[model samples]
Target: MDQRTNRTFICSVLFIDIVECSTKPVEEQIWLKERFNALLSETIKDIAVNDRILLDTGDGAALGFLGDPEDALFVAMELRDSAMNDQRDPSLSLSIRMGINLGPVKLVKDINQQLNLIGDGINVAQRIMSFADPGKLLVSRSYYEVISCLSQEYAKLFSDEGLHADKHVRQHRIYAVGHYEFKKATIGVPVSRKTAPEPKEAPLTDQPQQGENRSIDTQASRYRKTITLLLATLPQRPFHKKWISAAIPLAILVVLFAAFALRGGKGTTENPSSPKVVTAVPRPKPSVTRVAPPDTKKTEPLRSTDPSISQPLSSKRVARIGFTLSAVERKGLDITLTVSLKNTAADARSVALYDNHYSWPKSHLTDKGGRSYEVQEVYFRKGGKRISMYDTGKTGIPINGGATVTAHLVFRKFPDSSREAVLNLHPFIYYGWRWTEHDVNFPDISLE
Candidate 1:
């Protein structure tokens, strides 16, 4: 038996696919294949040939790296940069999407008795490749975690795209790797600099010198001293004396007015005992009208307690189903969501919910400002244990007729000001060798 056969080992798998390869002409396609193969060879020249296996996949290829996982990411980035710089034929310019995953894969012999690799790692890497846009790269959570520990510079290149839901794999976190050339291009525009004003030189003129200006200063000083002497000679009363002299006469007038008032009131008091006919004036009482108190019986707004009521209405019946966002909780940079899915069909044994092979379900939160928060992680909340989508040993949950399952999905946190967000669930269903994506829009839910 070969030493590389029937043995499982940890490695990184990189899957790449050319964008719109079928649309190109036969000659152009041949040129692109040659160009891309040469580019890949040049990119991985530093890596040992035995440590990496390049398998052609019709339009693109799958690279298996048994060495350090970071080497795979570095190669993918190099391939992207090299392809971008390839200006031989603009029409044959190759734009590819790449995905990387790190996991245990087994090396086995194919039907032709040739050594080949197959495992969940390769499948996941292919799925992640589907998530990336043309000229972009994406990596599975496992690959990201491995490279994160190996290289900080490599880890910083990835942005958290959040949890992605695939048909085979329910939900897994994926990260988008930043392209070096794109970053440089985005920051290439230089900032405008302000020009400083030119200093104006003094005009040469027959103006008075320092000695001439000193005479003017002396004359101004003499004039100011003369004005000060005049001000000193003028008669001015002290501030306290002026206030007291004005107050004495005002006080005397107030005392005389008070004496006259007292004298005038004495006559009315002395005549009061002679014949004061005391008349009692009756006070009018305020009228009191007794009114009925308002009805305090609190009427609760009619709300359905059934869990299905909160489920968003399905726009199109791709698989005869219903989905509802039960709860959404956000803490710092993490968001937790509980979604209820019910199978509405009675005759269908198993309904295909959604297909995430080519693309993930666009399950994301959109704020009023048009910012989107993509789903980051997904799991089945079964009792106390959380079943991850990447659990290869377990198959997808089967939903028979009238059966329902609660899916717990976690998304990247929205901005702080995003109090209310519209949750959009776009699921692509695979049918008849083609994919049909259904757009299910849920009403805006509160994030508070």
Candidate 2:
């Protein structure tokens, strides 16, 4: 096979390692690797083949993401969840550690003319993984700085773990990954186009990932082009010049005629001969009406369709639309609430509950102690695809008039001391190009 020249690029790399594969027996080791490979494939199935490069490392593997940086975080979260949640074959369960870094990597052909990755990017990723505990994921400071600034949701997923020194005495700062449902972060933020630094012998090109060449023209660009085109065609259109010269006098006459007609055809009504009379109308003084606050402490019988779910109060409609509390479940540090949106309108309306790219009226949980918990993720079905709210490719979900749609909202686990909580939900209904916010507060919700 013909070998291609080596190329260096700036990208994000993920390094994973089995906890103790070498200590296991040969049969168990084979089973472990097989299970790991299968899980990894499922985790990264949604990503494109060309956007990522995988290199087998015997026990674990290294993944280089040539696309978005958040791709690495998603894969890591999914892999960790799958490994810990696998209940089958308790004796041979797998545990792995992961690390992510954003740095420069060199792609070259190995002895067999196959693609291989070698550089400080992969090396630092391995070092970061070493600092992680079993079934944990850690990331270097470089990766954290770039990703955290992208969106508020991404920033909430990381916490600084301080700096650690490696064997070579080189210090590296790392951040521990917090527990979160696997959801896509907003990718609208612009990244630097700088490339990896190269040696004196070979220089790397200053460009980012491919497919970025197809940027769409903005409104400003189109307006500027239209103005330039009009200027270039003005001199060639002799008829337009003559038309403008003749239209000036015609426009003046039309303005004078409209002015004369506007005065009831009396002509110069403001003159001394026809003095105008002005009367002042007094405006009514503004009156203030005081509204009583809602009784949050008032409790009603538990109303729920499912016995496992508990609703302390009756659910009310927001914006003439109703939401039925279908289910509420708690597992570990996660709480999932399911609801169905009922539309009573005669026509279809587009609805948007959540999105990371744009800030909207949010839904959250507040305990009796006044502790608030923000929503971690939202799930719904659109066009037969399960989507994360605000992370969907489309702008909103469409529901026909008199139709209903079911959605699930995942929130951080409630504290044990807080046996009851209140939920504030904000959902937006789309009106052509505009959005209208309809908020509902469900108080006295039993968490126990």
Candidate 3:
């Protein structure tokens, strides 16, 4: 074990890391770095090996060892135990991943005069890292076999999930020793850092997989399940629409279908049984039918189509007005919306708002097309007088997620110049709560 060049024994390079390092925020870097450094120093000091700790790779540590595979397995297990039993701050606790490979290595001095180690040992160790779980350890067969010869301590290691030679050239056989049962966890986040060597692309084999595709499949499955559960408990109701606007579409379809059936696919050919012809049939009788000349109806311009420039250009842009409701007193309707402008743009463009207040859509709320809600009317006060020029149009605002944005709607009469009018709107709004809800926060709405 002396510092000599005569050593030619098979040595294993082991890599260890904490899983799910991405969840740790940049704000906690100081705390994480301290805990990780301390833990590594302590663990390495306790392990019986002539190994040298090469570097601190953020979430995990990299180390080079000059021992047989058996000793490497022992060191890896101890590292996992230390992490769990660590007496440090609970918030700073972490896990580790250990990789092992048997290869020749040589230690030398670097430009900074620090002891350095290199060879196939470190490479294989990183591969083992991909195979291990939070509290488990994985080792290569070369490692398992050689270490088992030295001692039967790690003979129970077995193959785990995928022969995990992931997309990064990091490949290996996995193992889960001890009473630890691997719990299925969604990879809700990703990890960062590992500057020693850039990750190389994994070599292709017989079976290849796209991890991202699996993730998408997982999300779709969750969405389907959520919909199923919601429908199971939700009340069933027929979908309706806004009056004549709704009936017109149905009427058009009915007419088209009727015409198709009557013509029998003859392409506008007349049918003797059609009402148009049947009613006029014994026509010898004085003609009682009256038909309008085609020119009698006035043509109209479509909201979108530009058949010709002869049609006058429209100057109407849909405009909306909304307001923010900060802290509303349910009793007095006294709210605090002192203009929460996060950051204004250089052009001073459309002012961004925190959120809008809306009365939750109810009876007056039209349940058109199976919507969970309807446009809720909202009101704001000016000079102690209630004004009702608001829109229930835009449903929810990007207020942290659940915030409501009542749009500017048709203005109607207010109760009186003395009394405040009640505007129908959804009350609950979410802000600054991204963890509880995604950033579905609606932008602040206004009547300005």
Candidate 4:
């Protein structure tokens, strides 16, 4: 376990790989590497050196951020923007793919006594990068889980690309950042006069099939012709009002005969031979219940038979606050949950998400067996504003009157045997000028 006595910690690693670098000529490859290094350095200059470690991978590079996970994301976005805007030379265009992962890494010294990293953290980061297309940014599910909750803006930037299987057959769920076009941009630095080779054409297999195209076109033409004939004939009446009146009387007689026929078959209707049609109806959603204070009379417990019911908690402050458990996801030892909070008051109220400065814990998860898991992080988002876990301010995020806000909470060391858990929120919400220690519990949350 002491592979490196130096230090072992979890960090967000950004892995970048230059596309098709091996096919380039010796002189062009050298120039491309130089330009990439310069751009990467410029993008990360604002980030402190002590908080990050950079590893060169010959074709590309990896950066492990030991501080906030957002640091790696910021650098990735900046590097992409800078690479796209560089205008040095037309031949020096570059295309790169990036991937980010949050995992465990060990700080070790290389043969040259230089600091190096080795672990699943950077390895998975590289795997994630390998799945990306040129000019695109992809992030592992672990990284997305942490960073997306930091802010609503960050969350909106990600679109789920679904699950992918790597070479090792390990399934990875990845999220793609905002779309990007693979365009070339040059910088001001002078380079060799050699012109870059043109991109190769797509393989024949990627092209559309001629037979399939012809079939589709024929079907479309027939549909268009049929529609044109109908449109051309609609204006001409097939028969006048006199014909319509005669046809209506015959139609009513036919309807009357059919009604009489059905009435004569009432005996058969009592036990029809035809099968019955069963319509599927959706189940009603569970209602949100307000948690009463201890002094208040005890309420009836929810019927334990229904799995769809969720017992939520609430506050009885001047503005009633209610919570509805939205989603719960468990991956390995981590547990992530989203709770929707609604405020019924007329004005916005400040609610503390988490306060590190306070002595007591703000929230946690407990199982039926009484095992408790500590809350690792919390993020609160309301409208366009977001509150990060690292915020130092005492006042928490504000929930507008009658507005609903979402709170994402992450817990570590989840109990493996527990299929149901309870989330307890304590002393975080403000009732008036002072902080209220009233305990709120959301019970019987299904973890399966």
RMSD of each: 32.2, 24.4, 29.2, 26.4
lDDT of 4 by residue, 139-241 (tens): 9999887665544335656777665556554667788876433111122211111122222322212233333322212222332343333345445654322
**Model 4 clash pairs?**
86-186, 87-186, 88-186, 88-187, 88-188
TM-score head-to-head 1 vs 4, winner: 1
lDDT for residue 309 in candidate 4, whole number 0-100? 38
**Which portions of model 3 miss their true places by more than 4 Å?**
1-9, 20-23, 47-53, 151-153, 157-162, 168-171, 179-448
State each model's CA lDDT, in order.
0.60, 0.66, 0.40, 0.64
Q: For candidate 4, give the lDDT of residue 28.
A: 82
Q: Candidate 3 lDDT, tens digit per residue, 61-129?
A: 677665323445545655666677787777666666666666666665557766556666676667666
Error of 1 at 394 (Å): 21
TM-score of 4: 0.41
Would you list the clashing residue pairs of candidate 1?
Answer: 162-376, 163-375, 163-376, 163-377
Candidate 3: lDDT of 219? 30
CA error at residue 373 for candidate 1, angstroms: 22
Clashing pairs in 2: 355-390
| lDDT for each residue of candidate 2 in 11-39, tens digit (9 for 90 to 100) | 78999999989999999999999999998
What global local distance difference test value does model 3 have? Answer: 0.40
